[model samples]
Target chain A: MSEIIRLTTPLKDEDIVKLKVGDNVLISGVIYTARDAAHKRMIEALEKGEPLPFDVKGQIIYYVGPSPARPGRSIGAAGPTTSYRMNPYAPKLIALGLKGMIGKGKMSDEVKEYCQKYKAIYFGAVGGAGALLAERIKSAEVIAYEDLGPEAVRKLVVEDFPAIVVYDTHGGDLEEMGKLQYRE
Target chain B: MRVVDVSEITEAVAKLCIDANYNLPEDVYEALKRALDEEKSPVGKSVLKMIIENADLAREGVAPICQDCGLGVVFIEIGQDVHLVGGSLKEAIFEGVRRGYREGYLRKSTCHPFTRANVGDNTPPVIHYDIVPGDKIRIVVAPKGGGSENMSMVTMLKPADGLQGVIETVVKRVDEAGGNPCPPIIVGVGVGGTFERSAFLAKKALLRHVGKPNPDMELAKIEKIMLERINKLGIGPMGWGGTVTALAVHFEMEPVHIASLPVAININCHAARHKEIVI
Candidate 1:
């Protein structure tokens, strides 16, 4: 059984140290959004020894490209996209002090290993619960890659953002947990 | 031949786009409700609850069920005896999609596959048309999200490969998909058609009400067996541990040449947004 962890703003490596697969986390803080295209640019900037657009240390990145917001709304129905697409870029970010990732789907072996080595957690948000999830985001502003449209990077203030730990620093996985329970 | 004006078709298509995006189909809603009851894990149950609540919120005008309203996918069935008047049928459908996405506050998700550039306003929907027997037009709008579409696969196997081959391929695909397509998914399998046709049938099969069996007893039996095996994979709702990995499996089959057997599997996440209108 996994424990529920309450996380606040300015997440730290120590805050995620005890997190294991199958844990439930209710996060309250600011998180940045980046999908496939944005991730590429961030990593490319890092590789060139150039300064990143935003400080990634102790930060969590959500993989999402939301719909256009309606009138008076800060953001549209915002839900996590598949994480596997970010597998190639995730470990690189983790090495740069990134503490967590929020999305749906399993990570690559390298990503899992990086989490175990670097004290990062992989959080799974309800895949289609965009509208409900968006309700948690108090505000949002485009931060980088404006030309990428929905794929641009954005800074968001969220409250009680719900997620489950799919992968943890301890190398555990919820996918394995379920498979064990259901395996005949 | 009867003539149907493009403007009328546009109105029908527009309504379909909005309704399909906003409301969860009754059959799909029932399936999710049933899954919530059957789900064993606390986490799985909670996830299911949130999904149900999301649907309710969307219906109540609180929010959309999902943010990715998806590129408009329209399937049109025109009666052979009827002619479209005033303008191109395709253009009118595109206009409807544009208006619906704008008025409904649904996202415009279409982009260039390689360049990844957005086509503003979500125009030029993917329209599939077929001529049928009636003098009336039938339109179905299914907004397929990216997560589920990413998990879809198409495989071509030898005729000698048979049923077992089909089963193994599907299982492999689902296993590989893991939590990506979102668990408690609905699996749609298309068998025996040509390559493209098989893919089409797989997507079309998703239109069936969840947990409802195919009319063909043999295919229905296959669906049941596949459903049992897939759930047994332990990929529960949202890929968390539970007994309700997939709410249902739907299959559509067509005759193929003796030398070839093609299979395609299209997965739909819990949302499964779709609606239909006829005129």
Candidate 2:
């Protein structure tokens, strides 16, 4: 059985430890958005030992590149992007004390191993539910790579953001577990 | 010759692009609902619930279905009797695409393939036009996102390889794809057509309503079988593993040369944003 938990932004290492595969979570507070371009920059920054644009410690990074907001709207359609593209960079971030990742799709083996070793959790939001998800984002501001267009990194404040645990700190994966039940 | 004004076509194309991007078609909505009910994994079911809810919210003008609005793919079936007037047909279509992306507030995702430079306004839509025996023009607009588009595959198999080879290849492609294309996906399989035609047919197959069978009984059966086998792979909604990896398997096939058995697989995310208009 899986438990439903509410996670706030700047997620703690302990909080991530408590999560397991198949857990349903309603995340609130702050989450940072980054996609392929941002991920590349983040990793590059780490490699250069330069100051990162944002503090990743005890933070959750969401893989997304939202649509442009209409007037008066803080953010536009905000759905999770595929996570596999971030696989190469994820372990390094995990080594940096990153506590959580929010996206859709399967993680690479290295990513899964890092999550287990570093006590982090991988959560999946509904992939196409951008409009609904955007509704939960109370505010958003570009933090880096403005020229990358939608792929820019944005600091987001959200409330009741829905997600489910696809990978957990203990090496349990909802994807693996679910497959076992249905496999012929 | 019937004269068709280029301006009229441009306006219609623009509207179709915006409409297709913003609205989730009725048939697609129903298909997701049915998938949710039939999905066996609790986790998968929950994901489907979110997808359905997202669609409802999009309909209510709450949000766009997905963040990636995708490249504008326009398929035009021109009436053979019609003669284009006023301006270049291709230019008119491109103008429509530009206006639509801007007005719709949709993302501009097009870029140079190798250099990876943005194309500014998402112009130069991938227009596939065909002249047919008709008095009316039929346009089908499908905005294909990169995630699923990236997962698409084309292969040339030996003639003796048979259906088993086709099945194995598709399964491998999806398996390698894992959650990248955003399961529960809709798999569009194009078999037997020439290399390029197979790819075209694969994309066209995605325009069909989920779970709807082909008129050809043989092809329809193949669709069902493939659907079952894919689900059995245990890649559920969003690739989290479950009994509903694919909501539907659509196959489009045509006769090909004896030497070739070309197969193309195109995957559509849960969003499956597409719409049609006739003028």
Candidate 3:
């Protein structure tokens, strides 16, 4: 195992370019959350020339719809959702200078291509390890699309939020590489 | 004859909903524990470790095992000698689901399929009922997440296609699923039934204990073979690749028409959550 890279939100191109597939990352600072419904609305807003819920530049979007938080909790059993559903909207956001995404599962070839062209990265977290992952998130607040319920866009303050770079700007794909290494 | 109050059914459903989501079943937990040792990839091993840890944390009841608390799927086996009183059986199960999500802090995942409006309170559970020869009712609550449910399929094959075709179809389904359904999955295969019955059988197969074979010797052999073939796909934990893509392959079957050999594959993610109660 190599050293774990530490990063904060509003990530820079230079910061992303240095990363590669299979690199472990500890992301600290603010990350935004959005899933199926929120993504649809965001795409619609952009088509109509309205501003996004937040500035997309340099930020990472986590694909998740977390369970409700109980009393005295910042968030509830939070973890990554499958990322492929966001494929339809991710390329546009990547073009708008979004630097990274954190989720589980494979991305479409088009999404990977945009990541390469835009110098962004795709990270994968343990998909069902929600309770364990929740401990790393210090706070969460809904910033947009509250009508969407769990799919509402949330602005989260996280610390050492762990993930692995599955797709890097250099055309490295960990999902492809890792499978080949173990496929018997 | 024994009388069962609808209120009792409602309360039991509510508790089972919370229990299923907040706790990982022992069979699934044990499967993951074994996979950790057998997984070849470092990343796969670590992912398995974290999943195990998450189950441990979820048991404390602060949160569910996963964020997608899933659409409540309840199975009921009512005894023939029992009389249900006080209310509608369907309404009782739905009420249980609502109360469970509300009181347990689980995510309400049901919604309008086309309009995409949130149901707000995870109600109208998908209920399956069976009549048995007893005085008790067996209730099982299995909260199935969207990720894995999307990966499920029902296929109809020629009678000539036989067992080999079924095995190939199941293996292909898992291979195509890649990592999307959450690897280290449990595959439930239903064969030898009509289209809808096959689908139901596949889903019901998932309620069985992980890694346990069918009591029928022939079906057990097929399950063991399919499990080996699926794990060889190397989708690993969460699909990043490893030696253990699936923990088990559970098979269930029923008699079919002479011309049809319908098969259904229902995939369950690593966070397989189901609980049962007898009352």
On DockQ, the leading prediction is 3
lDDT of 3 at B216: 96
lDDT of 2 by residue, B72-191 (tens): 899999999888889999998899888888887778888777656678788768989899997788888898999999999999999998888998899889878877888888999998
2 against 3, candidate with superior DockQ: 3
Per-residue lDDT, model 3, residue B87, is 89
User: TM-score for each prediction?
Assistant: 0.97, 0.97, 0.99
Of the two candidates 1 and 3, the one with more favorable DockQ, higher being better, is: 3
After TM-score superposition, what is the CA distance of residue B226 in candidate 1 from its true location, in Å?
Answer: 0.6
Regions of model 1 farther than 4 Å from truth: A1-3
Candidate 1 residue-wise lDDT at A62: 92
Error of 3 at B146 (Å): 0.4
Clashing pairs in 1: none
Residue A136 of model 2, lDDT score: 92
Give the CA lDDT, 0 to 100, for residue B69 in model 1. 87
* DockQ for every prediction shown: 0.73, 0.73, 0.82
lDDT tens digits, residues B248-279, model 3? 99999889999899999999999999999999
Native contacts recovered, each model: 0.75, 0.78, 0.75
Assess each prediction's global lDDT (C-alpha) against the native: 0.87, 0.86, 0.92
TM-score of each model's B chain?
0.98, 0.97, 0.98
The segments of candidate 2 whose C-alpha lies over 4 angstroms from its true place after superposition are none
